[model samples]
Every structure is written in C-alpha cells, then in structure tokens.
Target: MTLKGQHLELLPVDSPEYKKHINKFKDLHLINLYKIHYTGADKNNNSDDSWSDPIYFHGTGHCGCIDRHIERRTGSVRISVSEWCQHDDGCETRGILLQGHCREHSLHEGRHYFSEDIEVALKYAADGLQEHVASDNLSNKARFSLFLCKARNIHLGHEAMHRYVVSDYDIIPCYLVIVCRQL
Candidate 1:
C-alpha cells in the first residue's frame, strides 16, 4: 500500500529479514512485517539530514500517527520547557551531557520516545496492543507493535530505565512489526 508517496512492503514469512528477527520474538505470533520507505521531508523540517544511529523497538498506540508522520514528515523536540526549574532539579542540559529529563521523567508532547533494547520495546508494544484490543476490539489475542527507527540524533540518559528521547526529524520510523501473544 502507498501512503504519502511511501510504500509498505509486506514481507513474506519466509523472508530472510523475518527469519532474522522472528527468533527474538518466539513468544509472540507474527502477523506481518512491513518495510516502509519514507521519501518525504523530515518530520521536523530541519535541514540537518545526517542520521545519527539506528534505534529499534518504538511502540505507539495509534497506527494513524505513523501515516500522518509519513505524510507530513515533520516533528519537533518534546522536552520540558520550564526555564525557572521545577522538574527534578530542572531538566538536564545539552552538550557533553547526552540530554534527558530529570530522574522524574515525564512524557512531553511532540517528542518521540524509543529504546535500543528489544525487550523494552516489546513491553511497550504489548501495553499498546492491550489498549487497542480493549478499546477497538481488534483482536482477542494479546497484540503488540514495534517500529524500527532511524534516529538523526538520540538523547540517552536514564539507561536503567531504557528511555531514549529524541526530537525534531531526529527519529524516523522505517519498519513495522506486528505480533500477537502466544496462546
């Protein structure tokens, strides 16, 4: 299927890529694996087009957001904007610091969150799937989703929590992973 000039290629179960990642998700049933080609502008419209590193396992509750992201290809940094300080001794600063919210991490709108660890991503995808299943009645089985992303810039902090915060065309969703819980 094509959306916003991007094409979604559904991989066959026997494809090498599927076989490569399927082992890691043995507990779940694979519904489909899609490889998305994003040819649109960066989500944030930033001119710095350098991709930093590839990150995996980004989970989202709404599938529409991915479509919207592909259509507009623009995103902004989502971080605490408090200048006077209040959140966890104030938000962490940039430079050699790697950049992240304080110990009390809070979700900021417009910011993309992800983790390098597949386990973390799986947990998030599972939670999102549960929500969808309950609200949309999409499936009786435990559903989960994971997005393989390319990050132009990544903010790593709170390693113990596996919270990777990025902003402004820094993160792009490239692959879609759909799985159902093993019965």
Candidate 2:
C-alpha cells in the first residue's frame, strides 16, 4: 500500500548515514532505510530536536516484508485502533486509545510502545511473521519471494534498558528500518 500523507526518503546503501547506522545489525539483510517524515501533531515540537537521537526501537510486528506491512502506509507509521485491539469492546476502546486516555493501566498508559533492545524488537517481528505466514497458504515461490526481496532492495541507535511509552502528541516515527532475518 502506498503511504498517504507521508514522505519516506530511501537512503542509498553506500551513503555514510546508512553505513554508520544500519551496518551494525548483523545477520539481518537490509531491505530499506527510510527517513520518516511525520505529519502528525507535535504538541511539544520534539520531532525536530529528537530526530537525530532516535536511539529507541519500536517493534512494529513487521517481518521486514514491505509488501505486508500496513503501519508503513500511515504518516505516523502507527497502527490504527481497529488494527491494535481485537477484543469485542474494541470499538469503544479505540476512542480511548486514540485520545491517549488509556491511563487506567500502567502498561497501557501510552499510545505507542518501543524498546531499546533490537533483539526484542526482532522477536516481535519474527512472531508477526509466523502469524502472517500461518494465516495464508502460499506456495514455496511466494515464500521465496519474500526472502529474495530482502536480499535485494538497496537503501540503507543508542542505549536504554526500559521500554519507552510515548504519548500521541510526542510520538513521531523518525525512521523506518526494514531488515529481513537471515535463515
């Protein structure tokens, strides 16, 4: 799906930015490195100040396959409410989550969640891959295409122990790093 209301600048592989930032992740094939341009409301104007220090990693449940990732289509690079919670009361909870009103629960306080550990983020991506692959019955060729795409596509972070819970206003997806796990 085409990204609406967002502009992603794909970085070249030989670029200094890609080499310095993306080359650290070993065993993961680079698919794309996009500098995210968020069009969402910046209540504190932190996007400009914090764009260079995007040391945090957000697990988007994407297995590095661009074709299957839905969150990338949004300007905020965030999943919609319906795509977030699948419970029976999701319709009602959607509003609360969207408004950043989920302060009742400690874990659900923020609208977005991120991790500092790349491995943890990768685990989420792998888990998502399982779910995605299981839901569909694709042929071997299709599965190969997913990995092959990772092999191609030339384009192409910091220290924190805790998970980051960002509010809707302060949340801005600074970059999009797409990497496929080497099997």
Candidate 3:
C-alpha cells in the first residue's frame, strides 16, 4: 500500500538499508529527538542501562526518538515525541533542549501546551511505517511494532515549540506528538 505519492517498502530487519534509514532519521534534526537503547535484564531479572539519548528535541523543530525493548520475548521499537516546552525565552531560537517554562517570556503564561491532534500524528506515523515496510505481507507483530516506532518518532519530532505558538489557543494540555514528515 502506498500514499502521498511515495512508494514504501520494508527493508529487511537490520539490513544496510534499514540501518541507513534509521541513521538518516536520527540525523534529520537536533531538536526534541531522543534515542534510547535497552541493553538487557539485570541480576534481578529486571531491565538495566536504559537512558534517554542526550539529544533533546528543540521546540518546533523536527527530531527522532528511537527505543528498543523486549516484551513476551519479542523485540520492539518505539519512536515518539520526547517533550515540549512550556515557556518562551529564546530557547526555541537557540535550538537547545531544556525543561521548564520561561517565566519572563512566557508564551502561555509559562504553561506547557499539549498536542491537540494526536490521531493525525498517529496516522502519519502509520503511513510512514507502511512506506518503510512496503509490504502488505508483513506479520501483525511486525506491523504493530513498526506502527509503534513510527508513531513515537512522529510524536516526538513534531512537538510544539515556543516559536510555533502564534495565539493563546495554541497552549493546552492535549498531549500533541511531533510529526517529522512535515519537517
């Protein structure tokens, strides 16, 4: 299945093409993008060494978040928005990823705005996965995993920034995910 005039195909897992696509996604932008890897279980049979990539999503900029995990003995990847800014202090201008609302130049009176159209983001992510996977014959598990990864990546990539806020209405707690496709 194809959409938006782009032909998509799911390259083999861990293939050179797959690695290239992932790397390209990572290098797209420096803002709000985060990469996480789960090493393995600990002595207590619990996960360990799981941490967020140092790269933070800059407000209003496109970024990618990648995560790997195991559940029920199945491997999974998740990509999504990391976080959005609640303040406006030229932070968005500098493309630096940080937390907290800027009190001085409060865009929403120093309040963070949540996303309003998560479903749209989700669809976009699904489409992306479809393109990448490029095969209608993919297993449900593979498709589901791809959906999760794409959704997370889009969510994190399109997270709002202080600069994107043009009106007071843009500020809300709706949990908006980023969409890199737009970038």
Best by TM-score: 1
lDDT of 2 by residue, 103-141 (tens): 232233433344555666665445444544664543222
Q: Whole-model Cα lDDT per candidate?
A: 0.48, 0.41, 0.26
CA deviation > 4 Å runs, candidate 3: 1-32, 35-96, 119-179
Task: Give candidate 2 misplaced runs (Cα > 4 Å).
Answer: 1-5, 40-44, 47-54, 62-65, 68-111, 135-162
lDDT of predicted model 3: 0.26
Off by over 4 Å in 1: 1-5, 41-54, 62-109, 135-140
lDDT of 1 by residue, 6-116 (tens): 345666667787787677565667666666543444343424557644445676443322222222212321222121123343212110012212222324443556777
Clashing pairs in 1: 42-73, 43-73, 43-74, 43-75, 44-74, 44-75
Report backbone clashes per prediction.
6, 0, 27
Question: Candidate order by TM-score, highest to lowest?
Answer: 1, 2, 3
Backbone clash pairs for candidate 2 read: none
Q: After superposition, how far is residue 43 of candidate 3 from its true place, in Å?
A: 29
Q: Which ten residues in a row have the lowest lDDT in candidate 3?
A: 1-10
lDDT of 2 at 38: 33
